[model samples]
Structures are given as structure tokens and as C-alpha cells.
Target: MESQTVEYKSDIPTKHKLFKAEIVAFLNTNNGTIFLGVDDDGTFLPEKVDQYKQWESWISDWIHSAFSVPVQKFVTLEVSAQNFAIHIKQGDKPPYYYKDGEGFNSKGIYIRNGSSKRRATDDEVRRMLKAQVANEFESELSNIQESLTFHYLQDKLLDNNIVFDPKGLRLQNVDNQYNNGALLLSDQSPRVTKIAVVDGLDMSADLLAKKTFSGSLIKQVDMTLEYISLLNDTKVSFTGAAARVENESYPSKAIREAVINAYAHRDYSLSADIKIEFFDDRLEIFSAGGLPDGLSVADIKEGISAQRNPNIIHVLDKINYIENFATGIRRILASYKGFHKEPMFIVTPNQFKVVLYNRNYALVDDDIQSWGNNKLKTNLSDAEQLELGFTVNQDHNLFDDSCVTELEKRLDSKDEKIIKLLRLNEEMSRKEIESYLEEAQTTVYNRLKRLIELKIINKRGQSRSTVYYMKANESK
Candidate 1:
């Protein structure tokens, strides 16, 4: 109803060229309605009722010859003599221009801007041309060597009971000439996916481990998931009776979906690599390029998706890595239902990031040391140490030397408390240790199990009668 995509004119122009620019603008834009006898303020005043038939004949002939494709079907004239409205729908084949003698040159292209028509800029014209060719960069033929192999992708497809044939590649927009999507799925794709484990919440701390997974996109997704699974430590909890509860550092399903979504939807035009970082209390996955055009975060939250790389998505879906399009975010959120911290998403024009919290490690203050070697000292700043709930002494030795052994060094402060209490009492039941430490029964149980796994302490008996003690031959 507003004048944004609608325009008004006092009367049909005698010189038809005066209104031809407006027609080209509407065809190039979202299409619009033009009222010949309406004022700019939207007041309808019929002035040229007698010339309606002549005006319609002239407009129909002009549009048919002006555009690259015939657009007479897009125009409609109101039959009512009291109101003259010519409706123009957006052209399916864009970059609509005036038929000048030069033959579709820069001078012909017009675009709608606000309430006026203007000549499209060179860049705008180029973009329109690209859009006309099916908005997919991955479908374009690649200049890379055609002697390419997709051994990894083939194996995955074979396992899924699907034949990996050359014709299949063409069907999926991949041909003998390797395209961008084919390059990504090739056995020797140069794109590398990386994961880095840091000693602290920030990268300023020491790098514990850094691994790069490359080659085919399928292999990279598989290898990355395997590597992260190895790092997903499990925590234990004990209650009234001896209970062993397994707590995963990060939800397995969420990590898989995030990694696959990153590879599937990433903008390959950008050379930036996908990065997965592990911190003290969270994990961050950064993928180059943001949401696709016309898509927003809210749209993704509602399970709406616009595929920026349809070719890549097609291959990924066929491999069964993606069950459905637009369901990755919803699946990621569902995986964190019982988790204390929800996943966070940060989207920008050129980048998208997913931040997942480590709920198991959330309450473990001294878990930061797990990332360091036995000889490594705390590199955390004074403020960071305080924030982590650690009281720094002048000596800077947060843990007593007597409480740390080669195997027990990885244990957190609470685990040390349980060990100290056990050593002092020689042997203590689960209830006795929980009572002495005045800690949550679940916390005590997790610590006790961790100590046992480290062989720093031994648990004897079962159920409510279970008691823990340090190994007799082991020295503190």
C-alpha cells in the first residue's frame, strides 16, 4: 500500500519514453503497481478515461520489445474506467533493460531505488547477471586437474549402499571437470579443518594439542568427530549408595551436527579455515561466512534454512551425515536440554560461530591443570586465578607438593581433598568421606572415581559399604 514498490502519476504521459524507465525499474526490482490517474499523495483522479485503450496497447508493445524476454504477461490493466492501474510483476529473468541500439549495454539497465527509478550501477548489473545464472558458486566448473579421486567419499557412499558413479557426480552438479563442491569432496582437498585445545579459557595460555584434519570433506568430518570424541572426558557421580554417573564434557550429537553444518554450509569462496577451539569451560566452533542472504538467526532457530551451497548439502545429505536441512540448530539445542549452559551462536556478515559450554567441567576449578604437563606451572593471570576461585599465595604453589603424584597431578582440588581425607583416616567409607569433606555427594563420588582411575587410590567393597584408600606401595 505504501509508495515503496508502488508509484503514482497524474496522467498517462503522451511521450511513452517518459514512463519506460519506471517500467524497467519495476521489472528489475520486486515489481510494482503504477496508477496512471493517481496523485503522488495517493488521491485517485480519473483524467484520461477515454485514452485507456490506446494507453494499454502502447504499454504492451513497448514492454515486449524493451526487455530481454517478453514481459507483456507481467502487466495487467484494471478494467474499471474510474481507476487506471497497471500492475507489473518482477521479471523472472532479471537485468531487464531498454532495447537501445547498442544491444543490452550498461545504458539500458535500470533499477528501482526508494520511490524513484535510476540506472543500475555497474556492480549492481554484474550481481544481477550472476543471480540470473542460478546463484550457486559450487556448481561452476573448476579449472583444477580433472584427474581427481574421491576415495573417501566413495567409501562412505559404498557403505551407505549407494554406487559412486561418474554420472552421479554430474547429477549432483559435479562433473568430470571438478567443481568447487567436487574439490571439497575430493581426496586431496586443500581445505583443512583444525581443532586446538588451550590450557585456559583464552588462547593466551599454552596450547595443549592442535590437530588438523584435511582431505575429503567426508573424511574431515569423520576424523574431526573422532578426535573430539576422544577428548570428551566422562565424569562420575556417587550418591546415597555408590552410583557411577557418566558425564560427557560436551554432548556428542551437538558436536557432530555443528561440525557437519560448518563444512556443509561454509562459503568456499573465502579461504578461511574452520576452527574448533577447546577452552577450560567451553568449546567454540568458528565457520567462515555467516547465514545466507535473507536468512537470520531467528529463522534458523525456527528451523528455517537457506542453503548457500546446495551442491555440498546434496552430497552431505546423500551420505546421511545430514538427516534434514535446517535441523542442525534444533538438534544442537535439543542435545543440551539437561545441560546447565545453553549453546550460543554469534553471526556476522563474514563469519558464524557456535559456542558450547562444558557443563561437566563448569564447577571444576582446578580442571585447567588437565591441559598442562606435570612440570608446567599455572600461567593464569592473577585476575583469572581469582575468577577461577583459586586463592593465590605468595609462593604461587596452589597445590601442596605432598598431595600431588605423577598420576594424581591431573586431578582437581576436590579430588585432592578426598585423597587427603582418605590418607588421614587410612581408609574411609563413601559416606564418611562425603561427611568429612562437607561436599555434595555427587561431587565426592566423581572425585573418588577419578582418583581410582588414576590409580592414586583404591576402592574396596561395594555399595554402601565401599571404602577408599591410597595404594599401600604408592608414595605421595
Candidate 2:
């Protein structure tokens, strides 16, 4: 039957162009077998026996001159007394095009489409080029001459009863010649892994803390995880009978999987670093390189993965850093099912970001109606106006008189404090509120929830970057 990898020719065609297309198609695609004596209807008609050697010679010379690299080794001619078959193996370096002045540019690259050969489109050619680069990049040798150390990786492998000797390293593509993958796992590789904690939601805010970890990538994974774990605080709730319900700010498994995914799949060719930013409302992990070719965000969410660095994945898998391929995104989503806000993935041509919101700092939905309440012309109670330190002027009106009266009736002292703080600033984060009031974070959180319920203020942004603003107008 006709397929992408098989083409049948009834007899030797008169023109060399027909053979050229089929051979180029096979080299661009997977290895294919071309049967010379077979017709579309499966009838066998042999070509002149003496012409077999001539045809083979012509094809070999044409392919060698047309491609940038020698393709003679990939082309083989099988000539039996009764039949002839031309077999072409897929080329390692692809986008094989016709020689210049053959009436085509790089877009002249061809691939098998069903049983026919067609020129590749610009996007298709680009994908083929990227795939070629990705496959060769990790196994390529690096110039780093420093003696490599793998104490961390060795210990991890030894714990699992796996030997990590030089021979084993070469087997895993980490040879003494120091491949790019080896540079990544080296103790003094130039790659940097950093985490930044910001006070505000975006980088516009002050930097509270920043930590950089360098060394072997495997060791960086552990060090980064340990640093993040310190910030993944647990909240304890005591209801009754000495029972406590504890919840972490971010799920441990989800963060671990994301970190592992960053290290294993990130593009090492770029000089960019892998960064993790912690804001008051959310955590974001940024890795160099976008989704690997032939993959989309939806595909990843559905558990489809394309490894950009197979050798890194191989070494990581040996050390138990990655349990299964293509399951990281699924596991991350599953870790937040039902209760936590779902994670978000942002992909660009050069970068991929994972955003995880803090479950405990989620905004109360009641605050949605209170946005834009600043235009309301209602007067506030004397005590409420005094607490907010505002006079009911046309522009400074905090809420409608009715909404303000309702708010004053319901707000406790801490609620009043949060509302007062939001009144002074255009917006305030949960942490900022906590700091201003010198109160416990949970206490500030509860007070903000109450203010939201009273419709005195509205929540804006999300995650650690979330901010509270006084409602511009109150809903009827």
C-alpha cells in the first residue's frame, strides 16, 4: 500500500526530476523504500538490467551535490536479477534542498505527504531545522576544560543502586570530552538558577530577597527546592477536639515537578537563566525556550511532551529527578484540583512561564461588585468617615451613603483598619496591609475578607501580586 515511507514506480521514468523528488522526500522524512519495478496497481515490470547501475550512479551524484553533507552512505541500491529497490535513510542534517539555481531556495525542501512528495512550507522547514538542532545540541561537545565533578549526581544514583562511572557517563552522553549536557551537570558550569522574592505583585515593587544557586544542575534542583520549601509555609486551622487541618502555601509536588521540568527541558544553548519569582499572591517560574517544536500549551496540559534535551532527561531519569516523561504538567494541575486556584502557563517564542497562585490568599468573590465605587455620592457615617480620614466630597466620596452605612454597621475594628489603609493608598497587597497594621498575616487576611464582604473595598490582580482598592462605586 502507498504510504509516506514507500513509493512505487512502474518503471524508470524518462526524467531525473521524478527520482530526485522521491529521494529528497525520503531524506527529509523517515527512511523509505522505493520499489522501481512496481506500479500503482501492484503490477511488476522490470527495467533494463544494465540501466540499474546507471540510475544508481546518477542518484548518488545528484544527492551528494544537492545536500550540504554527504548523503551517499544513506542511499543503497539493491539489485537482484529479478527486482530493484532503492532504499534511502533519513538524513541527520535536514532541510535538504536542491542546489542553488535549481529554481528553489531553502523552501525547496521536500517531505513525503501520504504517498506523494511535496515541497515543505516555511513553517515546516523551520520545524525541521529546530528538530535537527535540538537532537544534536545536547550531545555536542563543550569547550569547558575544568575537571568535572558529580558528587551530588553520584550520591543520588548510588542511593538507587545505579553506578555513575566515566564509562556510564559516556553511555549517558556525558563523556570526558564535556558535552553541553555535561556542562549543565558540572560543578562550576556558568548556568545560573535564581529565585527572587518581590514585595509587590510585579517587578515594580521592592526586592525583598534574592538567592542564586550555581553548580551542577542536579544539585541546583535540590538547592532550589530547599530554598522554596522554606517559603512554602503551612497554615493550621483548629476547629474542635484538638483536630488541626494544615495546608501549604503551594503544593510540594507541583513545585517540585515544575522545577524538574525546567531543568530537564529548558534550552541550554541560550545564555538565559532559569528564574523563579515569588510575589505576595503568586509564584512564577520562567525558563529559557518556549514549547518544543510540535507541542502546544494545550498539548502539554493533556500530557503531551516533547523533550528538548533528551540526554539531560536521561541522566535526570537515572537519578529519579523525573519519574515519568510528559506527566509534569498533568501532575501539577492535579495537585491543585478542587480547592486551589489552577496554575497558568504562558508561552512565547523564547520563554515559558508557569504561574501558581497562593490558595490561602485567594480573593473573596463578594468584592467583585464593589469595584469602581469611587464615583458613588453617598455620605458616610461620622465615625466611618473619621476612620477613613475622608470627607464626603464629590471626588473623594468612598461609597454611596447607603453602602457606607451598611459597611459601618458591619465592619469591626480590624476591618476598619484595612479599609483605612486601602483608602490612603490606591492599592495594597495582603502582605503590605499586614505590615502596615503590624498584625499577623492571618489576622490581616481575615480583616480583608470582612472588608470585601462589606463591599468597602475590591480585590485586584492575583496571587502574591494581588492588591486591594476601595470600591469606586457600590452595586445597588
Candidate 3:
């Protein structure tokens, strides 16, 4: 009747060492209950349950004193008329040792091999060390303890006026050894970010560029962004009375946020590197591990952030690199809020990925209408149309005096200036525009009113909080 998670004993063991191993096995593996008055056949013997309270106290005290760590918290003794159950929950810290006399032995460590407890192997002991620091992985001692440097990260901290204190940053643990956090931020870190820019839409396309960035993770992220910026091309549109709209192929903020998210939350235990594939149609950032245990795609989309590597994110937050708003997933979605092409988040048991589509994917010769004869324009939003770089009106040239000259005449120098200012900033308050324009309040108001009527600019909010921006109804 006994299984991996359930054990029955007719009565308490005569020796302390025998029963202690059973409790340790439960802690190391999945938690199990040891029933005092239950036999192997699941037969209850109330006569065998004599002195239950004394036996319970004796077992609890022996476990607290015999283990290498304070494991009393993981143990619970439940007493009822039915039986005495020693309930041991799976421990957060592993390698729970049973001391022989005053000193602990490697053989003292036990795990549930099957239904029975056995001495753990050397490899299992090492794994237990990792589990001990699971919540703060950066505090785990580095594999390479010698010759680690943090020049790049040091300078970053210096620029931000923070002293380079390894102990203060938790780059070193209690033993004063350089921890995994220090290794990652050091100049000699083996971890690297790999990026492949495909010339075409998929991997079958020729390789336009391929790069590997190494050194400190902070440096790697910056270097990767710099290399990708060459591929993040911008398209300029010169039509419409509105100032020429200039947009990047992909949102810069979204790209950076995704990279940071991959870096901070990735499973460092895996040897696999962070891989980014840059294609004409989309960018996919593949991190080593999948979503944290119990996290779902919908939960992540709603800005629920679970830390797989808490210390790595903590360091980034201290450097002011983090957005200090919602999770990176939310910020990435915000970047593509008004676009038809949005980002996709994919997860497997061993992988987590972010796929961002190019906002300009539907453009042909910098014109959306020319792409399949405006087939893509049927359901596109104002922001999507703006990114494609064209005016809705028949007059293609915004600056052409003869083409839509009536509309141009209506937009005098002041209206043109307002439009130009709005183009620079996606949205500006009436006060912010007036501060920059330094013109009469009545004159600017009249120009803003006229532009809104023409729909050259859109007004949002009300009274003092009201803001005006080019390409009307973008928030839609």
C-alpha cells in the first residue's frame, strides 16, 4: 500500500537514525506522510498507537537536532483519533543531512529512490546545492572562481554614481566567493547573445549578417542593439499636409524590452544561449527556458511578472535599465498597440520566445496602396496607414502647390508649424505646444481648431489636459 508519497508503519522505529532517513527522503523528494498506527496493508491498529504524543515529540526533536540545517519548519505532526501522521513537505533547501554523532556524512543525505529511501549519489548532492539557492540563483558560487572582472558593468555603475561593491550587489555570497551574478556581469563571462539577421522572411534566405555578443550581460545587450540597429531600417513618407512621417521598421522600445526580458528571466541553469533571429517579416527572441512554473501566456500578457532569476533582474533594476512601469511584456504590447501586426509570445517546456512583426511588412515601394492594390488597407488603423506613408486624399504630394492647393492655403504658416511640432512628438498638450510656439493663445487655438476640423490633427482629453497629435484617431 506504501507508494512514493505515502508510507505506513505499524509503530515508531526503535532507532532514531532509521526513522530520520525516512523523513529526510520525503523532504528531498515530493512530500509524504508517515502514519504511525497504520500497517503496510493500510489496516488501522489503535492498540499500536500508545504514547503517540511522546513519540511525536521525540521524532520532532530528533529531526531538528540531527539535520545540518534548521529543518523544523518543514515538519508537521498531526495528531487525531485516527492516527499520528508525520507530514513532511518538500523542502526548499535540499541535501538535508542526518548527522552521525556531531559530524555529517555524505552518506547521511538520503532521497526517495522509489518507494524506499537510499543514500544520494554525488551528482545528486551537487544538484541539491543548486536547489538550496533557487530563489536567488546569482548568490550561487561561480564555476570559475578566479580572474573575473566587471569593467563594463563597473563603468555603468560609476556613470550612475553607484560604487562597485560586489558584496553590496550580492555578487559574492557569505563565503566571500564570487557568485554567478558576478560571473555574468564580469568581462570574462562565457554567456553570450547570438543574433542572426536573415535577408529574406525565413531561415532559407541568405544570411545578410550574423553576430555574437559577449562580455558582461549589460554590455552584450547594448552591443546587440547596436548591431541590430543597422537592420532596423526606417522608411520616410513625404505625402499629405501632415509633416513627413518617419518610422522604424520595428518599434525600438519593443525590441529593447524583449531583449532585456529574455536576459533577465532566462534559465541560467541551461547551457543554451539566448538566440535572436532577425527576419524581414518578424523577429524572434528565443530564451533558454520556458515560462516559470504555473505561468500562462494570458497571465504574462496581463503583465504578471514571475522571476526565474531574481538577482539578475534586481541588478538591472538598480542600473535604471528597467522601464520601472509594468512588466516588459506589457511595454512590448504598448509599442505595437495601434498596429495590425502585433507581437506573439510562444512557450514550450524548454523554451520561451517573443515574435514581433514588422509594422512596415505590407509596404511596397514605401506605399501600402501599391502592395496588392490596397488589399491590406481594408481593415488597417490610422497608425497603420500613417506608417505606410501616404495621404488618403487623391493629391499624393503634400507640398505640391498645384495638388490640393486649397487645403494647403487653408493651412497657413502657423498651422504647418503646429503639424510639424506634433510630428516630432506623438502627442503634445495645448500648453506644451504654446510653450514651444510662443505665439498668442487665441492664434494657436484657432490653428488647432482648424486642423482638428480638417482631421490633419486629432484632439484628445479635455480642458487643461487636452493634447493634439498628427494622423487623427491613432489611439483607436
Candidate 4:
């Protein structure tokens, strides 16, 4: 209990965060032994020996059920001298983490710093990665949630005659241990793709909509694309040569490639999530981490891609999520052809951003929206049309006159009078009905509300402007 590789606990911390955190810390740092049935002062509880099986089963279940990544092979338990010990070996895959009811603590990487344990700094984690020969973070084994389903992933790969083989897909290591990549592709993936729709350009602008997509990575991509597609309004220009020239505000191909690239090339090591923001004038996609060292915005524009998560890219490729390794930028650029504004790729020390300009931002037309009355056709009476020297096509009437004839047989005599007035005229205001029936406004209003519900006739306009009309179909 006093050694550098040993930690003492009088009992297993089943409900506390310390239980898994201590083991994960050991795996991320130097391998260590956790002594149960013993206190830090070296006091041993002999009764715990009888409950070793229960303790072991509980902990084993936690590691298996609670974690997404398979890391059971690295931890073991032994019992002797009234002390049950949990032996955690230093993992070949660094940065092991623990998850609780609240979910994964990405910053849970811990190390033994002499007498106690502490979180490993970014430098230490980077050093660990270097020592591990720069293994991609997605390739590292995890125990965040051991049980993962890939039904969505399987469907995507199914057409290619590719089965969901974790090992073959590099989602699992050679030992069949699922890595972070598996967690991402799994149906129970914890990774999230967040999007914000703002009324204006920046964070200071009003948020119009917000959505967070999760589950399988491929599913997230598909769903996010579908959502953006809905927002990317399609405009048709009738002015063009007999054929319709329809174009989306932003080219859909560019949006798909840009979104997939955000997930495929983003630095998975960073805790920050990929951010996609939709503004009135443009779309901005920002992923954690910049282009790999020695790569610049110019290189990216020239179609040079330095994949930070190649393993992730490979899985996506199997499902055709990517068109080609480095063609996303080129595709985005090509989409803006003939447009005055060009797409931009911004690279900072910690973030990589893609800004896509909107093509229809300036082409908004108010003439397309009509402020006409909500009627099937014109509000003019047949007499008015005839008086204006216009032929009122009797066949073009919205109301089926036969429909009013049928209602006459079912309505009360008082309601029949109102119905008769509407039948004589194309439409009638509430005041006109009240005047004809010589009834209180309240009585006429109640009759109209019921008639509208019965679907005998339809009501239009609002308040004093409200008018009732008999129609062949129910009002929307």
C-alpha cells in the first residue's frame, strides 16, 4: 500500500468516481495496484475476504457495461491475505478514461506523481503519444462503454459487401480491443455534432435554431446533411431559357464534403466538439485542431489533406462518406464556380474553419410572396365579374353548390337561413349573416364556429374581416 504503484482503499468504491478513475489513471500512467480491504494507514478488514466474489463481479460488470471501449484485458483482480487487489497495467494505448452516470470525462487522463495521482498535463499527454509512436487517438483502446452496436455502420458498409468487422476496419486493434474509433462508429457513440443557426453573423447574434446530432458517426453525418439541406433553400429561376435553373443557396456537394471533412480530419485528441454554424449570409464549419504541421491554408486550398485521424477517414471511406482523400477542398472551391464570392479555408493554431458563402443571399425577391385573400380563387362575386365585362367561368367556382344543398337537409331552420345566404352569394361576412338572420351577434358567431367544425362550410379572414364561404373541400 505504500509503494509508488500501490493505492489503498478500505472497500471498493462502487458508486464513487474514484473507483474507475484510479484504474484509468494507472493505465494512463505507471501500472499500479489498488488494495481493497485495507486503509491508507495499513489497517486491513478481514471481513472483506468473504465478499471478494461480490466485489469482483460488481467491478467487472462496471468495466464491461459502463465503458464503450474494450479495455478489460489491461485490468485484473487477485485475492490474498484478507486483501483483494486490483492490478492495472500501464496501457499500450495511452489516455485511458472513465465514464460515470454523467458520461465520459475526456480530461480524465491521470498519472502517478509520487505519493498521489493527478491529471496529466497536455505536454505529458503529447509526450505519451510520441512515446507510443504517434498512435492516432481514435486508435487507442477505451473502456468508456464496452458494448457498442454498429447496425447503422453495417448498413452503410453492407452494399460494398463489407461486413462490420471492427478489426478489419481498424476500429479495433490487433488484440480485438475496440478503440475510440469504434466508439465513434457505434450506434451508442458519445461523440456529438453540434450546429447553431443564428439570425446574424456571430455569437452575439440571435440564435434562430439549435440542434445536436449523436449516435453513429455515419448517421450523424447523414442526419446533419439532411437538416442543412432543409435549410439550404432551393431557388428556381423561371427567367432562364425554357428549362428551370434551380440552385441551392450553397452547393449541396460542397456542404456534404465540408461536413464530412470536419469529422474525418478533426483532432480527436481535443475535447472541444466540431462546431457548425449557419448564418444568414454564410455557413461556417470549424473543427478542433488546425492542419497537421507543415501544412498551410494554401496547401489545403491546393487539395492537400493531412489527415489527423486517418483511421476515422478509412471507415468513412468504406461507406463513401468521402469522395477522395484530398478532394473535399477542391470540391468546395469548384461548387462556387461563377459565383462572385469564394469559399474560404481558415487555419489557426488550434482550429480549422471552412466558410462557405451563400449564392442567393442577395437575390431575395419579395414579389414571389402574394398578399392575396386566402380563397380558392378571386373574392369577387359572380355579378361583379359579369358587370366588369368578364365572363365568370361557372365551372371554376370553388364551392360545390350541391354541398350547400346537402347541408340544408341537416341544419336547424335558423342555421339554414345563414346557409341560404352563403349559397346565394359566393361568400358572406359575419355581419351580413347576422343582418339577414336578425339574430344576436353572439348567436351567429356560435353557429359559425359549429358550422366550421362540422366541415359544412369554411371560414376565412380574421376578426371583423372574417368571412364564411361554402367550399367543396375542408379549409386547411
Q: TM-score of each candidate?
A: 0.60, 0.57, 0.54, 0.51
lDDT of 1 by residue, 1-476 (tens): 44648888876677655588788888887668888766778786766677778777877788677666678877777747577788988675678876766466677678877888889998777656654453366777766755678899889989889888645654234334657678778887878998887756898965656788899888988988987875676564433333345667788989998989998887777779999998878999999876764356887989987677777777778878897658899999999998778899899756899999897776565555544532433556546555555443221112333443444346665565665555434578888777656789888888888777766678778898887877742453
lDDT (Cα atoms) of all candidates against the true structure: 0.73, 0.73, 0.75, 0.72
Worst 10 residues of 3 by lDDT: 394-403
Number of clashing residue pairs in every model? 0, 15, 0, 7
For model 3, residues 1-476, the per-residue Cα lDDT tens digits are 78888888877678777888888888887678888887787788888767787787787787678787767788888988777888888776677878787765787788886678888889778756654444456667888887988899989998889998877887887777998878988999888998876656888865544578899999998887776665675666545455666767789999999988888878777788999998778899999866653357897888766676667777788898885454788888999988987799998756889999887676645453364534354456545666776344332212332424345448665566666556534578887778756788987898899877776778879998898877533764
Q: Lowest summed lDDT over 10 consecutive residues: which window, candidate 4?
A: 390-399
The list of candidate 4 runs beyond 4 A from truth reads: 1-135, 365-476
Off by over 4 Å in 1: 1-135, 171-175, 238-246, 338-341, 365-476
Measured by TM-score, how close is model 1 to the native structure?
A: 0.60
C-alpha positional error of residue 388 in candidate 3 after TM-score superposition, expressed in Å: 17
User: Cα RMSD to native, each candidate?
Assistant: 13.4, 12.8, 15.3, 20.6
Best by TM-score: 1
TM-score of 4: 0.51
